[model samples]
Target: MIELLIEQRRRNLGGGMSVGRVLPFAKRRMVGPFIFFDHIGPLDLVAGIDRSVDVRPHPHIGLSTVTYLFSGEIMHRDSLGYAQAIRPQEVNWMTAGSGITHSERLEKARAIGDHLHGIQAWVALPTADEESAPSFTHYEGNDLPSWSDGGVHGQLIAGSAYGLTASARTHSPLFYVHLELEARATAEIPSAFSERAVYVAKGEVEIGGERLVAGQMAVLKQGASSVSATQPSTVMVLGGEPVGERFLYWNFVSSSQDRLRQASADWKAGRMKLPDADDQEFIPLPEGDPAKPS
Candidate 1:
């Protein structure tokens, strides 16, 4: 049985850039620990006209940011005094436990015109780790687990799946996997986790005879057998134990609204620390609470 079907909302993120938002839907705020999900460009950027995937310094609290890319590169800098460049198949995991600031842009060497494609997700921290010390970690593609069998290629980006686990650590139980399938292939999806969903990334997919194209998400009901692809396709599979109810405002997420308000004030008053290199820029706090599904 299928629980829900969601068509991603194409959102313009300024500078003529846009992304497909796939999570925090009104019908279902989250699938497991995932609170926010965005699929960035597979778009073409001109050499002279477009220069970078520039994201200025921003603050986050009570959550972790996960960045996974399929192509291109990004240079990441954080208030924690961390700097690194992430390329295709790499992982950037940043936990904004108590609080943290960071920025992401095109890598200096790869800043020239090119194609960009990736997924960025936000996972809310459990109540216990909301105020824990912030941290950052990077993993190379070869460092994570991957497998090939029966025409299905899969990678465990974080957490455990298919009797294997990735090195990426999280405060809660969750799973994020990327799967690429050959034509006319069927991929088995075990019910190893409490919650799960399938996202069609590059081609056509079907479960229980329901078709899902690129940018569509199918929240599967219990007893999911497998997913079949009509043609060669790329899919992202994610879900896990719920993180419980949490409040959200702009870039901040917390179990207590008071914490969110405090973070908003601290960001506005310049009390929060920022990246040393890009501290000059900060995203202004939004007017009124724009909490989704309101």
Candidate 2:
């Protein structure tokens, strides 16, 4: 059974580019350890798109950012001094333990006028690992476990499921799987974890007799079982044990509001290091009450 259905909100990230923001919903702040999720464009990158479309360097703490693409490419540069280009089916996992700064650019897509589509999610760190050292890792598609059955294709993005484990390192119990279902095909939603949800990235799917179209997510209740595609569909199945309540503001996530405050002050005062390669410019803190958890 479905506990809640999340409608994706279209948020314009400036420069005529918009993304479907699905997580951090008001009614449900966190699903498992997954705190934030954004569905990037399946958009045509027109020639002469503004440079403003590129995401500038920004800071984060108390979480790990997971970037996976279905098409096109993203150039990632982070404070850890790693500059990597991620393509479809690949993973870019970056942990901003204590704190880290990074930027995402579409230089290649913009130059060639390509189609770009992807997902980016932020996983809240365990309270104990909130202040650990920051790190980055890029995993090739072959690095993950993939399988096909009953007209469904699956790849484990992180954590463990389907008796297969992903190479991407994880701090806590969780599962993030990418699935593609053929028309009228069905797939089982792993129920071993305490929290589970299925996101329809493309096409339509039915769960417990309920239909979900593209851009919608069904947060499943306990014992919720499987999903069947009404048509050929692409889905993202994710969730895990809760990592406890986390406070988030801007790009920061932490268990302590005091920690969030200090992070804000540090970035504002230039106490945190920006990405070595993309250090010429940085995003400033938004104007607001320091006590607010946005």
Candidate 3:
């Protein structure tokens, strides 16, 4: 009964770009197959003085764009050309099957000075794989799979839990851990997971007993597996292996709603082909939001 999946609070959309306080899909409530979850920017770019993040090139069929940085530097270009530069904890896994186009900037050698925190996730693809074609992967930060357990400090960047396995190659059967407790900790989550959630970013967390702070987001209700952390906290645990039935519009995630209305008529008839950036800046498509399916 503890289901409140979209609190939304991060909305700055300014120049440095910010808009991820919560945009839970299809009217809210963690849409099917996991649709949309933006938490971009921890904010603050200073180093030499360029600070970048220019998002242009759009068009996605099913979905999979999970870029997770904990602090600074991001340079990812797409349309299948693939150009990379992701620092911090490192991870830039893109998989927009069927159709693609991408852009994500802020790496002019750290945009001059250096400092550009991060978080960008949008995973929704499982309708036989939603076209399945485009692909890209980059998992650095020591290749992911850190471990501590007592003083807390775990990192399994994508799929698989406890035992550890984070090379970032998930289509389903997901996990995505990244805990970091300092004083107290305890984890044992595995009830087979049909759905689960937890997204704190700094301190305090006790799931199952309740007590989650720092940006709050704790949704767990289907059988209630297991999760713990009391003091030195920093969490992010997503579930997986369920692509039951889906069809989300906006960013286009489909199991068939006519393939999200043929990808909104191929991105409004432009046909679809935008990826390629020199400076990066193209995020426009929001007017009369209704192609049918409500």
Candidate 4:
């Protein structure tokens, strides 16, 4: 049986880029610590015009941001005085323990024919660690654990899965794996964790007698399950035990609603410090949902 199959919602960000939002739904707020998940373009970008994805500096709290790219590269700058370039298969893990401000844009050669494809997710920290010191780390793809068996190639994207543990520092028990299968290949997803789900990024897959296409998130039923690809496919498996509950407003996530509201007020009052290199520009609170991540 399948728990729930979530269809991605399109959020157009102007400038010819569209993000597929897969979490924080009204029906289900989160899967483990994953409070927010966005699938950014597999889209072709123009040279100078579509070059920079100037998402200006913004504030966040009580969560860790993971940016994984399948195609292009991004420049990440944070208040921790770190400026790092994240390329394909690299992980930019930023922990906004108490609070932090950061910015992201295209890599310097934002050249033409550059395809931007990636998944940016927010993992809510446990309450005890929510106010811990902020930090950032970049994990190269080669440092991560990867394996291939019976025509299925998989890697531990973050956390632990499939008898492999990622070097990426995670505060809680969770699993995130990236898998690719050849045509007509089948793989049994292990039940090592308490909760699990798989998101199809490309190709056709069958789970529980139903076909899941690209952009579909299938929450699995109890125990282990098998996924078979009718054609070449790429998918990501993610989940863990729930971290209790969390409140989210804008990019702020906390176990306390009052804490979240206070962070929102802080942002509105300009209390968060900005990075020196990218200090002047700050994305203001949206008049609409204000639910937008920084």
Whole-model Cα lDDT of every candidate shown, in order? 0.85, 0.92, 0.68, 0.84
- Measured with C-alpha atoms, the lDDT of residue 291 in candidate 4 is 40
Once superposed on the true structure, which residue ranges of model 1 sit more than 4 Å away at CA? Answer: 49-53, 108-110, 290-294
User: Rank order by TM-score, top first?
Assistant: 2, 1, 4, 3
Compose the digit string of candidate 2's lDDT tens values, residues 1-294: 899999999999877779999999999888899999999988989766777888989999999999999999889999889999989899999999999999998888678777899899999999999999999999985788999999999999999999999999899999999999999999999888888889999999999999999999899998949999999999999999999999999999999999999999999999988889884678899887557797
lDDT per residue for candidate 1 within 115-192, as digits (tens), equals 778899999999999999999999975667999998999998998889888998888888899999898888887587
Tens-digit lDDT string for candidate 3 (1-294) = 346644657665545577565536444535324566676656665645443345556677788878887777777878778889888777888888888877776655343655555567777877677798989999976678788756767778887777767888777777777777764567665446677777777677776677777676666777745556667777777767667656556666766777777677777777777765544445655564434544
What TM-score should be assigned to candidate 4?
0.94
Which regions of candidate 2 deviate over 4 angstroms? none
Name the 10 consecutive residues with the lowest summed lDDT in model 1.
45-54
All candidates' TM-scores?
A: 0.95, 0.98, 0.33, 0.94
Candidate closer to the true structure by lDDT (higher is better), 2 or 4? 2
Top TM-score hit = 2
**How does model 2 fare in lDDT?**
0.92
Alpha-carbon lDDT of model 1 = 0.85
| Predicted structure 3: lDDT | 0.68
